[model samples]
Target: MVKRLTKHGNSLALVIDRGVLDLLEIDADTPLSMTTDGKCLIVTPVRDPERQKQFRAALEEGHRKYGKMLKRLAD
Candidate 1:
């Protein structure tokens, strides 16, 4: 879908469609991090640092607890 940037005082803004918003599970107030990879523009939701840390810790704990079962299943 094509989008046009609208003037927002000094900056420009793109109006995100509702489908995109729902798919991304983001709202107008959600913070997003943007970057470019020399060719394409990349936009992603910014995970809260504290929440991310908690998630990583939980994932590590789960891996440790389930590693044996998972390894057995894989064999």
Candidate 2:
């Protein structure tokens, strides 16, 4: 979708749509990390370190639980 930057104080801002927000599992109060790759702008939610660790642990646990079934399917 095309978006135009609107003036806000001395800076410009692009409004994010609610659908996009829901897809990203973020809301207005979510902290975001914004960056550019020189070609495109990327915005993502910033995960707290503790939460990141917990998420990683959960992922590892899932991998262990499903590794055999996933490998069988991949074969």
TM-score, predicted candidate 2 vs. hidden true structure: 0.67
Computed on alpha carbons, the lDDT of every model, listed in order, comes to: 0.94, 0.94
RMSD to native, candidate 2: 2.8
* TM-scores, each model vs. reference: 0.63, 0.67
lDDT of 1 at 28: 83
Cα lDDT of model 1 by residue, 1-75, tens digit: 989999999999888899999999999899999999999779999979999999999999999999899999999
For candidate 2, the 10 contiguous residues with the lowest summed lDDT are 40-49
Q: What lDDT tens digits, residue by residue, belong to model 2 across residues 1-75?
A: 999999999999999999999998999899999999999999999978999999999999999999899999999
Query: Where does model 2 exceed 4 Å of error?
Result: 58-75
Least well predicted 10-residue stretch by lDDT in candidate 1: 40-49
**Model 2 pairs whose backbones collide:** none
